[model samples]
Target: MSFKSAFTLTSLFAVTLSVAAPARAQTTFVDRPAELRSGTCASPGEVVTSLANLVITAGDPQGQLGATPVEQSGTVVPFAISDFLAADHAVVVQQSALESTVVVACGEIGGALNPDGTLAVGMRGMSESGLSGVAYFTPIDTFQNTLVTILLVGDGGTTTVAVVDTTVAAGDTAMAGDDTTVVAETGAAPR
Candidate 1:
């Protein structure tokens, strides 16, 4: 009878410990889908290797702003994930052909993925100190077919927003959310 009681007590203790533990969030991964790297979508004009200046708003209290007509080029690839459960996975890399700027680290863009492969999040950007300034990328449309990238670059405490329309030839786009931005959709504001 003592053995049975001890065993029951042990089992109850184990159950209590397991139930009291906090739930952990799952980690999402990012991979470039082979389909996005090749095929008709990778062609010129169709590919998302460029950006166009749209709107610029100076956030500086001194009212200072500037813009250089940059003839820059880079590639923006769609993210492929092994686990769809991890919604915080952001793995978009922008490779520049110019020596003026290079993107070192790009983590999660602050958004959740939808069942249909549509990722819409607020825009967030980080720079490598004085080498460059923080730049935010916002998605203006859904990624089910194509991706529209809206970029807001911050320099000298000013903000410049550029709009780039990408023809993914059937792809999805996700934007990160910004806590500073009061936008109802992307959660990102021009910085």
Candidate 2:
């Protein structure tokens, strides 16, 4: 009730609020740090602006946790085209007990995960201009050794999604889910 008491309380609240804020990172951190060997970029800012601005966890499509972006999967996590940061190519992740990483353009995943064509797997954002970058994804490997699935989003509304059987190994093209053009045959008669 007293002015002094009120001022002290307010100051305490202000101190707490200030402390709650997050601290900035001194340097950039990347899953593929070694791959980031570029003389053109030697600073944190450059690293972020060069490739993979963020990582989305399996479920957390939005970069809630810091600049190290990851795509969280399991629960239909969506990656925004703008978040791709065309200034640099973006790394996509569908992380979980099983983790996978993919590189995509700005508007690659604008809507749902519609691997609609026989070529690619992704969504659309803004106009056709959004998803105009190289599209890549990784199988749920370990922290540093995830495989990249290189494929095109293809014409029409098709996002090429394939299941790569890791057991098949990278060199072998027979691996299922390897982002290949192999189509799965479903039950029922064809016309």
Candidate 3:
């Protein structure tokens, strides 16, 4: 019957639709596990807040993971994420000396998978215009293919010692990425 034929076509169409649709996002290496280097840290509570003067270990236009606002001596100074081999895109920050050097790395992350779309699309894309050029700041507008917005949300967390992962590596090619300009205000004990 025509009704049976119609149903068959519809089922086929549905199957085709699903097959043609784009696949889900696949993480090649979603380096979310932000663990600190045990031996390198000086003290138990001494936090590694930022990544300053980071040396990118890969990429053509090399990138560095600096620009982390860490809580240090009741002040925020640009520091590195880990003792070494950082995640390049994550940061570990301490809230209030939670545990002995108990560092935490968290932030809003999402981004463009393909060109002409979004990029480093975290919770939301930071208006590139918002970060024009005031000082040694992150290149917001010029480069659209980057993490749109990366800010530590939530109230003063329970943990005090944290590390902000810059995702940069050592011995990278392009020395264009630096932390001096990316971080804002830094913070109370971390900046």
Candidate 4:
């Protein structure tokens, strides 16, 4: 091709790339260990973190085109466990879906309040799935909302992960899965 043609092609490619790139800025959540410095609890202190209700449907992946996604049985708890973030220390919470069983894991916290008023934090804790490895949590602020990406290492070198977007308000009870199959089981087994 001639020099002019080559230059035009290069310019066109650059323009295409610029246009194709994501126009809106957004935060991305990742399953990686992050550094978190804890902050003092607001006022008298209370539980500030929890999980939202989620129903996992096994059959429909597309939700019948434009229709809303239907809820099904055997759903997974997106964030069944998390560490408590305090100004002094980070406390790991090993909570299972089963009300009878209890698991405990502890860790340290490093976090601070962002200038935008959102709390920025990270925590690393011992595995609550009877594994020898560690687990990590990183919270990302996207245009929609903040999400916590949890990386969990279970027994036999198995890894389980979930990106938790919804949070249960403090002092409120977290709803259980709609799946009736595992309702009689001894404990909550994450998928």
Q: What is the C-alpha RMSD of each candidate to the true structure, in Å?
A: 21.7, 20.7, 19.1, 17.6
lDDT: worst 10-residue window of model 1:
32-41
TM-score of 4: 0.28
How far is 90's C-alpha from truth in model 2 (Å)?
Answer: 20
Q: Tens digit of lDDT per residue, candidate 1, span 117-161? A: 545433233344111222233233453123423332334342222
lDDT per prediction? 0.29, 0.28, 0.27, 0.32
By summed lDDT, the worst window of 10 consecutive residues in model 4 runs over: 25-34
- Residue 91, candidate 3: C-alpha displacement in angstroms: 8.3
Model 3 Cα displacement at 172 (Å)? Answer: 37
- Tens digits of per-residue lDDT for model 3, 53-168: 22111223223322222211111223321112232232333322334233333322223234433333222112111111000112234342122223332223322223322243
Residue-level lDDT tens digits of model 4 in 107-141: 34344544553443332234343422222333333
lDDT of 1: 0.29
Give the number of the best model, judged by lDDT: 4
TM-score of each model, paired residue for residue? 0.26, 0.21, 0.24, 0.28
Better of 1 and 2 by lDDT: 1
- Best by TM-score, which number? 4
List runs of model 2 lying over 4 Å from the truth.
1-11, 14-20, 23-56, 59-65, 68-133, 136-191
Per-residue lDDT tens digits for candidate 2, residues 54-83, read 221222114343333222112111222233
